[model samples]
Every structure is written in structure tokens, then in C-alpha cells.
Target chain A: MAPAEIRNALASHPFLEGLPEKYLDLLSKLAFEVSFGQDEIIFREGDPSSLFYLILSGKVALEIASPGRHVIIQTLEAGDELGWSSLLENTSKQFRARCLEPVRALAFDGARVVALCEQDHEFGYHIMRRALGLVAERLRATRIQVLDVYSPKGVRAQ
Target chain B: MSTASHAAAPPARPVMEPVPVQIRSVVKETHDTFTLTVAPPPGDPVSAFEPGQFSMLYVFGVGELPISISGDPAVRESLTYTVRSVGQVTYQLVTRRPGDYIGIRGPFGTSWPLKEARGKSVLIVAGGIGLAPLRPAIYSILRHRGDYNRLVILYGSRSPRDLLYRKEFAAWGLLPDTQALCTVDYGGVSWRGYVGVVTTLFRHVRMQPQETVAMICGPEIMMRYAARELEARGLPPAQIYLSMERNMKCGAGFCGHCQLGPYFVCKHGPVFAYPEIKPYLDLYEL
Candidate 1:
């Protein structure tokens, strides 16, 4: 996708929508389209969180290793944003991301994006606020998942 | 298979009496949930139900449990209920053989937005056994496909093993303009599907929020989150509907057992516009 098309797409995403044009321009400079074939691992737990992703299409499974195998904790899809660990200082990957199908995403360099956030306090504040919202939402979702609200063992029928 | 187009009103006969019905079949849906197909006595008229209405199944001397109708509303030959063997009453009901007789009291409560949903895109979000209540609505929409635009189903279960209607979900996705996405809260080694809460599947849904009507059936917490997300994405609260649960006893309004605020969930609803019930959804121990 062309940079203009990518910018347009980002403009409509729930997370990025309403962001100023200047910030989108900055993001566009660093943004590039990346794709992964089905079953390919995008990032592994404990690996450096090198890039932030804005999923443009397809699904990405966020998984955690349990006793014997990896358990998918969450699935990210088009219009969803992930890899916020990229913006946090010294934070490595917390979950392994794998392509559930042919996946395409808008990838941003973590280091450069973090540097821009630090250099521009105003932009930094806006970005951090948005990321905070994402984090809060994810935290709520993760908390709900831990509750296992649907598990027969968790909630009994009334 | 079409029942009366609208069953939103109470039946003319006394609604509280338990009618004997024989179990026709019982199909295991998952490890814990099973679909029981029951037929009324050979000559007795089977009660027809709307999408979100529920039935009170009586297991002889054990007790009675409120279960949602999961089969096609159009099919009046038999009533199907997908029940999780979670409590004492359900356990007793599920153990009965095909020829066994059980008492049924209702096709009670309100239903999904069948009339208003016509010509609009429909989104059905179901979690676990919550899917059972919404299955009838899916059947209604597909049965009259031309009346609606797009049909989107977002279903999430605890795992692949817990997903209900696995084959039917695949078949629904093949229909024109219909999208069915399934996710699990957690996946095992052999599971290769999306892993997330039902809300995560919202990003994959294609709809004009203003033109789509959403029906949600899940845990109360899940419905709250899903409804909030839908509203955030521009759907009006009135356009989003949900099925609510309470400790229902009598299938009529006379019993206050299933009361929510001033409303009787048994009589006024199982299906309610999100805005109508949002205020009481968080009350303590109600």
C-alpha cells in the first residue's frame, strides 16, 4: 500500500483515529507494510519488542507458554493495535505473536517511535495517553480472560 | 417450519402449567453441554418460540431449570434446548433417555429483534452456552435471507472443545454476505483458531454501525463490555440488544423470583434493548 493509503487506513483505525495529521505523518515516515504466511511466528515471548503493529488484515494470535504448550491468550485482528511493549523502556516481548492466517500489518520501528515520543513532549503525551487506553482495555480483557467466565468450572448456570 | 411470525405475547392458555413432553433426542455439543430435542405428546401442539425466549424444563421430582430455546423457530415439530449440565436440575434433565418424559412450562420471555432487524445487517455475538439463545435468531435470519443484508457471528468459547455448532458455524460462513468468526479464550496444542475474548473479534466485523443491529448473549460482564464496544464504534444503544438471566421460578409475571428492578425478566424479557436494562445491570444482588 502507498504511504497515503496507509495514512488513510490509520486515520480510520479506532486507536489511531483522531490523531493529528502531523503525528500520522511522523508515523507514516516509519510505517511499512509487512506480511506473514499462516502459522508463521511474528514474535516470541522474551524476544525484544522491536516493532509496534497496526493490523491491516488477518488475525494474529497472542500466546503464552504454559506447562507443556503455548496457549493463545488473545487474538488481534484488523483495526486492532498491538506490541505496545515496544514503547516501554527495557520491556521485552510479553507474548508470542503468530499469524493465524495470511496477515498484513503496518509496522513501526520501536526505537525510533520511542525516541520521537521522548523528543516531543506534546506528541509523547498524546501517544502515551492513547497507549494507556489500549493498555487499560487490554488489562480489562486479560482480567476477564483469567476469570474464565465461560468455563463450566468458573460460572455455574443460575 | 415457520411458527407464528410473532410470539412476543403471552399464550392464551394459562402459562404456568407444566405440560409433559417426551425427549426425542439428546446430542452432546461439548463435554458439558448437550442439546435436548423434545416433542410434545403425539397430538399436542408443541409450543413455538421466538429467538431469545427460554423454556422451563421440569425433570420430574428433581427440579426445574430455565433453558433457552436453541433450535430454529420455524421448526415447530420439536423444541430444542442446548443445556450445560452445570447444576443439579440440568444434570437430572440431561441424563434422561430419549423416550423419557419431562415437564415443560414455557416458551417464555421476549425475543430477538426479528421485525426491526429486517433489512438491516445483523451481528450476533455469543459466548459459550450463550450461543444457544441466539441460535434461533440465526436460523430466523438465514431462513429469510433476503430480509437482511449481512449476517455476522462472533462466537468465543473456553476452547475448541467448548465451541457449539462447530460444523454449522462453518456452513453459515459459506452463505453470501454472512461472516462467522470463532475464537477461544485459550487454545491447546492442536487448536489453530484465534484466541481472544469475544470483543477482539469486533475488529474483523464489517458493518455500518448505524445500519447494523447487534444481539448479544453471554455472561453479563461480557455483554456489558461488548455493548460498550459496539456503542463506542457508533452503534446506538437502542440498536444493541442482549439476553439477561435471573433466578426464574414461575414462567409468568405473577412470580417475582426473576425480577430486575420493576421488570419481570420472565415476562418482559430475556431479550432487552441495551439501553432499557443498562441502569439495572450493575445493581447488587438483585
Candidate 2:
């Protein structure tokens, strides 16, 4: 996917499904396309929270690693977003991402997007609101996994 | 061996409602915590609830916490929650009185192993204030004591005085085929009961690992270590279920404060089968 093709795909994504076609055209100028080979590492967990990517082709796995091990937390395929780190004010990602298969993605420059947001506050508002919603959903999922209430003490709850 | 007995067990219940509600009673159980009894605002009875489901209690100036439903589902007019004062929102809830206004959001998330545990023994292990989340299961099992086999509750706290519902535990034990056991990390001169760690208390009961459904809630270390012990005792991962907790804000699954891998404790579960969560158990602050 080229820059224009990547942006077109992103505009068609479920997240941006309801936006007007003109907005999609405006987005085309903001995206860049990149590709990765199978089993390639997309990003490490602690990498800088720089950019956001949308999948063009292939699959990516978001994984969490501890001592000598890693667990696949989520998988990304066509149209799914990667590098959601651009949303959080946090400096690094909480999970590492790897290409599960040969993949192509549309990348957006985080700084440039932030700049766009600063200039065009309306567009920035939509981006921030959508990004924040994603963050909220992910946070809820992480909480469930971390709080293991299913011990032998699986006693009743309030 | 007892498949015949399982067929006789009652069906499991679900917890979800769409009615508005208000606080009916707030009994100060501990110094900074209370057992909030919320009834349907004014008219209709509350929707049904299962053990392990939670509702978001919202205060005007403060926020909300996903407090588990602590009482029986048979009586659905009101729900109970034992909340401790840990943050600003909880402190507000703890300080409120009987008639004070508050918001109730859900009875969200999955229920415990009801039919799965039928005709099999139940071993409930809880630690600290974690015991609050497990209280409803205790009451539910005992409510239909004859439908199941043995019921054993193993609860632990920091100290003997820190135990919740002491008299109730004693009373639960007196019921046929039921027992209440407790322990602490350390003991004072007045402490005459088990003292070491909650995991050590697993030694006292005869847990038929295969047939028993182990429901546990406690700190991460306690659940991790306890699960190890139970597995060593012949309980496979499938036979175990764990309730997960995260910084839950919107019980309806909107907030990012609580996320564990791909599941939302506020939505998919606060209760998950051990095998389903075993992979991410060790992930830090995931």
C-alpha cells in the first residue's frame, strides 16, 4: 500500500466508518505505507510512543513479555490499528508488537498528527476522543486479566 | 462417582439489571468501610444477580468502584456490598448514610462455578478484604446445602481482628456438610487459631482436587502461590477459576483503568477460569 492507498484503507476502517468522504480525502495526505516480513518484530514493549499504524495486509501480534517469556495479548489484521501508543501521554508501550505473518501497514507521524490537532482543533478532538476510547477499552481488559479472583478462595463477591 | 447427585443440583443464576436504584442501608462493618444495601430506587425489585457480578456505585462529587454483589440472588429487591476505604470514591461511599443519594450501574461480568461445582466439594479461599468478593458464593452454596457435597471456606486476613463476618463463618460451619476455616499471616497473644499464611491453611481440609471447584480471591501473590499448591494437590487448571480485579471506573466497560490482556474484568469477567488467565497471570500491571 502506498501513502494514498494506506490512507484510503484507514478511512474505510470500522473506527472511521461514519466519517464523511471529504475527511477521508483529507486523511490521505497524512499516512505513509510500510511493510514487514513474517515473524518480524514490529515494536518492543518499551519503545517510544511515537506513531499509530493501520493494517493494510498481513497480521501482527501484541505481546507482553516477562522473564524468559511472552504472551500474545491481541492480534491485528487488515484495518486494525497498531502503535496505539501515540494516544497515551506515556512514553513507552506496555506491550511489544510483532508481525505474525508478512504484513503491510499505514503509518502516521504522531508528532505531525499532534501538530495537526494543535492547528485544527476539531480534527484533533475526534482523534483524541477515538484514541481515548480505545485506551479505555484496553485498560478494562488489562484489569480483568491482572486481577485473578479465581483462586481456591473464589469466595462470593459484593 | 456421584454423577447422580449432580443431576439433582439446582441451576446456576445470572446477574444483570436495568433498573435505577438508591442506597437503602449502610451498615458500618469496619471502621472505614460499610456493607451498602441498595434496593431498587423506589418501585420495582432489582434485577437478578449471580455471585461474582459487580455494580458501579457512583457518588456525586466522587467516582465509582466495581463492588461485587455480596448477598444472595434469591432475594433480588436489594443488593449488598462490603467496600473498604482505599481511594477517594470508596471513602465517599464508606462515609455515606442510609438515605444519601448514589448511582448504581451494573451487575456486570461472569458468575462463579455453580452447576460446575454441583455434587462436588467447594473450597473457597480468600485473603484480606478479598473475602468480601467471595461472601456471596458462601451464602449461595449454603442456601442450597443439600444439593451439593462438602463446602469448605478457607479465609485469611492480616490479623485475627481483621477477619470479616466472624460469627457468620461460625454459623455457616454449623450447617450440614459445610465448614468455615480461617488463618492469618501472623498472630497476637489473643490469636488462638491457625497462624502462618493462607496457603498453609490448604493443609487442613481434604480437597478432592479433581471433583472440587476451587474459587479463590486475594492478592496476586496469594492467588499465584495458592494455585500452585492446589495444582500440586491434583487440581488441574480447568477446575480452578479466578476473579480478576483492576482499577475499574465505568463498570459498563468504557474506562481504560482496568484491562487484562484482551478481557475486561468489568465486562468479560472479574471471574475467569484459571487456564484462560494462566498465560497472563505473571504479566506486570497488564
Question: Which candidate gets the maximum lDDT versus the true structure?
Answer: 1
- Candidate 2 lDDT over B53-157, as tens digits, reads 777777776665678777777777778888876667777887788777777766677778777888889989887777787888887887887767889888876
DockQ of each: 0.58, 0.02
Each prediction's whole-model lDDT (CA): 0.85, 0.70
What is each model's TM-score for chain A? Answer: 0.94, 0.83
lDDT of 1 by residue, B1-286 (tens): 1111223667555776788988999899888888999997543434667789988899989998888999998888899999899888888888889999999877788899878988899999998899999999999999999999999999988889899999999999998999999988888746767887899888778899989999999988888889999999998888899898888889777879989987788887878888888898878557
* TM-score for candidate 2, residues paired by index: 0.60
Q: For residues A20-133, what per-residue lDDT tens digits would candidate 1 score against the true structure?
A: 989988888888999999988999999988899989888788889988788878878787887999988788999888888889988888889889998998888888999999
RMSD of each: 3.5, 20.9
Name the lDDT of candidate 2. Answer: 0.70
Real contacts recovered, all predictions: 0.63, 0.05
Give me the displacement of residue A123 in model 1, in angstroms. Answer: 3.0
Q: Any runs in candidate 1 off by more than 4 Å, and if so which?
A: A1-25, A28-35, A56-58, A102-106, A153-158, B1-7, B12-14, B42-46
Instruction: Compute the interface RMSD for each candidate structure.
Output: 1.9, 15.6
lDDT string, candidate 2, A73-143, tens digits: 55557756778777555578777777767998777778777887788888878878877876775565445
- Which ranges in model 2 have alpha carbons more than 4 Å from their true place? A1-158, B1-20, B42-46
